[model samples]
Target: MSNQLDLFHVQRAYSLAQGPLSNDQLYQSVAEAAGLASDALNQRCEIGRAKAKRSPLKRKIRWYQQTLKAMGVLRKVEGRRGVWELAEPTDKGLHQAPGRVCLLAYSTRLGVAIWGDNNAVFSHLDEPIHLCVTSPPYPLRIQRRYGNVAEHEWVDFITQSLEPIVKQLAPGGSVVLNVSNDIFEVKKPSRSLYIERMVLALHDRLGLSLMDRWPWVNLSKPPGPTHWACVNRQQLCVGWEPVFWFTNDPLKVRSDNRRVLEPHTDRHRRLLEQGGDTRVTHYGDGAHRLRGNGFDTPTDGRIPKNVMIKGHRCSDSLRARAAAKRLGLPAHPAMFPTALAEFAIRFLTREGDLVVDLFSGVNKTGMAAERHGRRWIASEIILQYIKTQAELFSQFEGFWLNPALAVDSPDRTGS
Candidate 1:
């Protein structure tokens, strides 16, 4: 029932094209290598229908080219119809490039993207990072191909990757980690304690202080733990992930709630217009009191609650994936929403402060930083991801806004 587009075939075509290839040459190469239908490869729409539709496979490949053009990697040869030229060699199986760290790309006066393992990259970085925001691979029972570890080893893996970067944090710098909450115990309905264990490890082993745990609510999140949730009905669908905020020094943590405030609700606005509560009231069993004067003073905006709501889809990410498919490229397994990164960047760091993402999947953190006029650095291990995420900075690098806001501006893109 799910006819999802598998990008693997598209990426294969790019891998086979060592240099410029004619339309037929590239199509044939991909069809042969991927064992695609010869008819699908050679199928041509009628001249009238050509503008309206194309063979599904061919159309996908062609549309992907638009993505490549944006990334500045693939281009149609000037005056050579049906011919294309690759700017540089594509990732030959997504292997590491020859170097300790490679500066893959950058935005004008914004940020730098580097290709290398995060641990290795951070070791050589001399600049003190003001914020380290990232979502490392979750600890799942079965590790994914993108280098996530087994549940038992997840803590150690993250600890090692972050230990060096934590040492380099500025005095009041914060580390906000987006971690998985759906991990369950082996063959049971019980949840795993890895999150708690991770918190302890960071505090005990790294000497960091726990600041606050922000809940990222995604109501549109699909159901999971098929065996327990759908079959046995032992558990409910998990709709939120925990975002743990930590800092090197709790008292001096660099954050301001006023910077990331939520718009006032109509009811609250009416209350403010009426000149405060008008009467003193006691709530919480008389433990707390609300005075009329409290609502009389006007403020810029309401302080946002800790529960952040956003969908997973990001416009830039969608564009990157489409481009990646066109170029026959692979993507990071999981990419957090752009709004989430923007929230953290705005709340924790100031303009021109350095923000770093150790496990910069598709470099969403870097994109958020650049949009907010903050300096950024990203380190990702996969060369293909480095290439794919590089598309974010291709055009409108400094002036781009979070596209998620374009459609869902209220409630911060809450579904």
Candidate 2:
């Protein structure tokens, strides 16, 4: 049996403010209006309440209504009993109750509470994942020191390891694998094993297709060097890493072609007022039409390119060290920044869709999922890391950590 805190919160909020509308009713309403019965109006309300338990429920409901209305899922009618309803008739009744179970188990909102051996995740996931962003262990000799397999074994291991996950990925979904070449000696650089080989293996072996290659450049320099280099400085290394963006089916991947431009500076404005060409200052060569509220504008004056700059660093936590020692798990060497994960979540997923990280390291992806309001499912092979992540999320979000919340405490007081 799955937990129902997420579902109960959504249902209770809907019940208190408006009449209890069945999932079917909500679905039908959405389908009629938008041709897509899947709307997150109620789902968002549930997540908002789940996150902000200290806040008043009325405030949470207001916030939910506003968010959904802005997203064009809730419509306001002019009638005696005009109220917020689904924008269209839903083809299928709202299955939020069952859906919430899946989310609560591994959702991004709840954070990295659900983690353990790989089997724990496969059992819990009910639907195919839409997108996956992860940087698994690289093929390096040093990796073996941490109990990870040797470098030569990576190809076979990665291939066999991801087969089950690929099976669970939706045909339309995509996976972005970020990896880099490992350095062994100061002067000797191993033949750069192109990640394309793995991409090809997945496609030929598992039917996953390579869609794109995203170059992740770490602008910041790493401090100091290994045994090979006494103190390497400004090493003309291949700083850019490869992120193989693969999809089960190429057609479903969506790219938002919007850009955010910097406003004209005062100097440029003054020049424009003087009847100067001002074209270079006001409308740059690559300028495009802006849309949506100014707040949600995309960065970079152009649609985000495949190559994303790695500008953020991993979180620093002494607590993680303690937890690692207690749990007897090797420390994670590299973790993607929450900001990077957030970018991927926003660009790849809709508001309420599930975002998964197959190889969760230190729960960065989970934190990103919570920040962006996306449901997440993450799996970590190590037990210690899982426990540490669960504790961190429970303390930070104030959500019930135990999955037994459904049967152990139906009162919902823990939330």
Per-prediction count of colliding residue pairs? 2, 19
* Model 2 per-residue lDDT tens digits across residues 273-323: 565442322235637533323323223333455677775455534555555
Q: For model 1, which pairs clash?
A: 10-328, 11-328
Give a tens-digit lDDT track for model 1, residues 1-415: 0012223334446656666777667656656665566686556554344475446555655555554445444667788877776655535366442334343444446777766677767887898899999999898776655656888888898889899889899998999999998898988899999999999999999988999998999888889767789999999888899999999998889999989988888888988898877777889898888775767877778998888888887797787777567545675568888899999999999999999998887888988998898999888767567656655566644533222111121222232
lDDT of each: 0.74, 0.53
| Model 1 CA lDDT for position 298 | 72
After superposition, which runs of candidate 1 have C-alpha atoms over 4 Å from their true positions? 1-93, 96-107, 396-415
Looking at model 2, residue 81 earns an lDDT score of 42
List candidate 2 segments past 4 Å from native. 1-112, 144-146, 183-187, 223-235, 257-301, 315-331, 395-398, 403-415
TM-scores, all models, native as reference: 0.73, 0.56
